[model samples]
Target: MTCFPFLFGKKVSSDVRRDPEIDEGLSGIRIKVYTYKQLKIASDNFSPANKIGEGGFGSVFKGVLKDGKVAAIKVLSTESKQGVKEFLTEINVISEIQHENLVILYGCCVEGDHRILVYNYLENNSLAQTLLAGGHSNLYFDWQTRCRICIGVARGLAFLHEEVQPHIVHRDIKASNILLDKDLTPKISDFGLAKLIPSYMSHVSTRVAGTIGYLAPEYAIRGQLTRKADIYSFGVLLVEIVSGRTNTNTRLPMGDQYILERTWELYERKELVQLVDISLNGGFNAEEACKYLKIALLCTQDTPKHRPTMSSVVKMLTAEMDVNESKITKPGLISDVMDLKIREPKKKIGLETFPSSYNASSSSDSQGTTISLAASSAATTSTFTLKHDQSM
Candidate 1:
């Protein structure tokens, strides 16, 4: 299978055949093969002004293709060899996936030391940029929009877990990875950390890599990841989308500092209404909102075996199946596994309804369930890698 180099008809390198990573998926797909120079021109030579997003892997720039198509170009960091691997992995996975709720890949560039992925530029960017990283936005994610996003994300996960050939486990499912289209329809992005599990294997053990707040306890502690790990992440994302806050925010009262624990606390007290974002200003449905919260709790249960599959999750969220509260157990606590530090909120927003550290003990807060937090200032970055070392 001899092919010309990207965008150039000339081919002379004999070593191209020996290197699988050089251009593994290029031969299989008919998508546009971009050259580094082409992308550079599209992105204004990777100018800082065009940069839209930055993360562990690389920086994403907003670019206009020669055909007048607007695209998002992700340029991998040259310093990190792992970034290149992630670039190839993303292409391998997302290239085959064609879903309404998944990001559309225009093409990619793998020339010299440059690695870039071109995607359809989403108008709303990401949920993180607009919602989670809140500061300024005309976008109002009302109750219906939030619900639609949840349902869309669930269907995407369902397709990956059930309908896909070998089944895909999205290790990193968070608000930042969720993009919104012009109509605000949700699309799951970033398959760099995704794991492809053959149907025969029940689970795969490897190094843990995902957002700290969304990490499943079993997966984080033992590196044993199954489809349930994605379920747990989706569960955390559900809570965030509904509450209009991140899973972990330090700028709040100790009791409410950790959203997962606070949401659980509200569930235990049968006061799940408290879990809704105050920003909604009483616009959300009480019954439906509570049901979504409960279903999320079901997904993040302590035992992965107890968690419902993504397909079932979709049916439950879409009101196709009645969620059984009796089946839910203790929710997986991320703070319990990692060193989480809580920061004090400003003095203006006093703790009113929630019991703070002062008098939380004697309060009849749902049968005397204690709310205590141990905080540490420790911080560490997250990354993904295979379990290649059998000796370790």
Candidate 2:
């Protein structure tokens, strides 16, 4: 799957040990482990023509089994340099999880040096390809279908965040990771960077790992990852769904490049309707569409405390409840965050750093800060060791 790029970086936890039961329980569940040879034959020796998708870790080939079932075979590159740890994480997390909006993992092939993943073949590929890629050249989603897709993804995320035994935070929630089935139903793929968040703890700070654009500010900058980080990222994805473009656009003029900035600008001007993809051609409900956009903005508020829980988001999107716009505040719009100062700590008497728990829109100029968005709304990541001083 194209969604597998999530594993090619620093986000994955290294401490997840392989459960002895993982191999022993294989006989009880429906998961099958095919030999490398079997998959090779099914994939026609991994021919280029059968290749349906690709990403950072490897290529996905469409295959037909001897029993005549179609499948998607993901073969990890030998050069990927990933070891047994990544393979075990994917298997352990995905095998235990089952939900309709989550991709189905049929099995895996781990023979010697070869590491391969098997999943159901989705005919519609991903939202990135059909909805946001190259301006919708292949397929167009009508308004009703788009609504279903959004609600479907929310339900999936809510399951992972709440229903699972140990709550899981899907560290990476972006357009590409969302695969579409034949009926345009959205299934979230790629659990490579998933982290188990215990019910007792509120947050964990680790080295940031996620796509640059969809990253949440608190998570990206300070490594304070909570479920809110995922909420913030989902807010960005909602923008992409309504507008049919990536969150950041480097090609456009400086002022109009970032989608969040553009959306907020329109929201403030009462021109949020204009933010809808013109390609929709007035087919979507104006009032409902704007409500969706507003909800997305609310999720992306600068303060993590302000974002709604995934359960609340589902109710709002489904029309079970109304979005209270009175609490909406200016979100932390990040554009030029590339100029971060992190990791290589230097001793200082009292380094003036912004609080990790940021709520206000802007800080005083006296404090050198990384959280402030430039006029262009450019985003980059940074971190610091803080020593708060109330004396100032």
Candidate 3:
């Protein structure tokens, strides 16, 4: 393989080769293939001053393209477990998907082993940064803005699940993966874990992989993959937006209660007010909050079948349904109570239910199981039973 230099002025093996017969998928758009050195020069050698954030895949840098356009460049690390195949898959998936609520992929450079994807630079960064990070207290989003984001994200997912010839399931749908433009509009990003579902298939079986805390109970425990899996993730993201708390926080006294559990507990007790972000200072609409919470609970229902389709979710968000006459019920957690199986040799994993300090590099066996990484503090442990409850 011929070696290529990266935007960081580092040498890397180039695995990309030209094949006249190969389909580029993105045929009409002109794409300029850049050598690593050229990208590095354009990005000012990937300076820390331009660094945005890092993820399981690789570090993302803010860079200027050769055309003098600002962009966010995701440089895939060669050592990452997500390899060339995954990189190529992300490119193929994103290239075919286009929506106002979805991030746009400007281009990519796949020379040798060095891989980089360039995207339009959103001035507002990610939803996670704007909402959760403490640095931006003065930045308050009104209820209308929040509702727009929820609807926009739902429409984007609806497009993926319904409009696309082969439905797409975004395996990773977290706050960090949702970006914001200058107008504070939400745009879904990070298609690295997306899966294309055949038109004729109802579901696909696959290994369980996703951010902790956000995985649907059925998908996490049974490895049953479906578009509803994306709905479950969207539910988690919605709750995060409403509450402004990280899904997996060790700071809470209750032993590592996943955000869903916490929200459920609060909602059941009529303490829904407590779930809203304190920063909002009770300024948000009560009806809207309750409606969104109900929608979220419905989405996070343990059974994939019980969850509403993306189309329904979008309708609910837009208030197209008769709000006054609507009757919604809490979706109960679904799992075999007797089984209550827990994957043993518990080590810390990613952003799911554990803190970053916990080791995330451990690999899981093929049984679609993972050990709990909750802290041993007695105040946090609660004995709860998994019941086969159904919700719609």
Candidate 4:
């Protein structure tokens, strides 16, 4: 058996100064401290063949531990200095929480310039790769399975938002981040963009970091984050899970391009049921499906206060509480704030084409103008950064 270091050294890097907060945070956390060599061997020298997923943060690879357990290793791109904060945040957040719907953290590696995260290897990929991306996956997602997945995701969010002390806000809640286990259970992954909200504070002010299509209007514009921001993203994911499509699809007709806009149009016309994916083949409960769509509308309302809490959303989905159509209003659609241009990709992961990731932030410059642009050319994903003029 290969011996590994279980404790972190006095200093992580010789060149970079370690933050006192990170040092204090790491000292108390109960997760295993892995070395660069052990993780490198575990991932077979980070082989390309072991890679299962890719995103702006980095790539995820499937690996086997010395004890014979399977795992997914996430290696942060060395170029992203910002990723170090995310890496530590992920370790600090997930290492303390445990839930069936939340992804499990096996351990992490932080040695020299290398940073990696280890998680239980999920058999099936994410909903974005399978359900919404379509044709690329062989898994069958009938109505019952889809319904269960939606609730499972909602429950996980509710746990984070309500049950956890100093409740957490998952700033990025999109299809690509929702992974599926062999039993088809939904596990919410990626805490890089997560923020913790203490009981006294209503919201936290920070630079915006999340995918474009799923961002809430208030958070995107004002740079103020609350649990409702996550509610908005979850609302979009809810629609995608039910409709089997991405939030933004330029290929569709102009009026039907944005899912939230189309959903609102249908709700007004009493044709909301039409938004359901045709792949269901009349197999789903029409009334329940429509109710789910309505609940989504409630979650995405323009005013943060207008949106229901995740726990209430759970009760609504489970039929424990009534969904008040009287309170449903037009969602805070992404198209209203800025125009998004979708360029044809050189390759595809699923059938539908959409932006892999989007990052925009508020600048602290004297003029209060923010100019940020980031671009990536990964085969399965790409990154697009934008400039922001809004000030909080």
Once fitted onto the true fold, the runs of candidate 3 whose alpha carbons sit more than 4 angstroms away are 1-32, 134-138, 323-392
Model 4, 64-157: lDDT tens per residue?
A: 9887889888877777656667778888778757888989988877666677788998888778777875566799899889989989999999
Q: After superposing candidate 4, which stretches have Cα over 4 Å from the reference?
A: 1-25, 336-392
- Candidate 3 displacement at residue 147 in angstroms: 1.2
Q: Which ten residues in a row have the lowest lDDT in candidate 2?
A: 352-361
Candidate 2 lDDT over 185-276, as tens digits, reads: 99988776677777788976555655545667777666667899889888989988988876766566767767888888989999999988
Question: TM-scores of the models, in the given order?
Answer: 0.80, 0.80, 0.76, 0.82
- Indicate which candidate wins on TM-score: 4
User: In candidate 3, residue 83 scores what lDDT?
Assistant: 49
Error of 1 at 268 (Å): 1.2
Task: Pick the winner on TM-score between candidates 2 and 4.
Answer: 4
CA RMSD of each candidate after superposition: 12.3, 10.9, 9.7, 10.1
* Candidate 1: C-alpha lDDT: 0.71
Q: Report, for all candidates in order, the number of backbone clashes.
A: 0, 8, 11, 0
Where is model 4 poorest over a 10-residue stretch in terms of lDDT? 358-367
Better of 2 and 4 by lDDT: 4
Higher-lDDT candidate of 3 and 4: 4
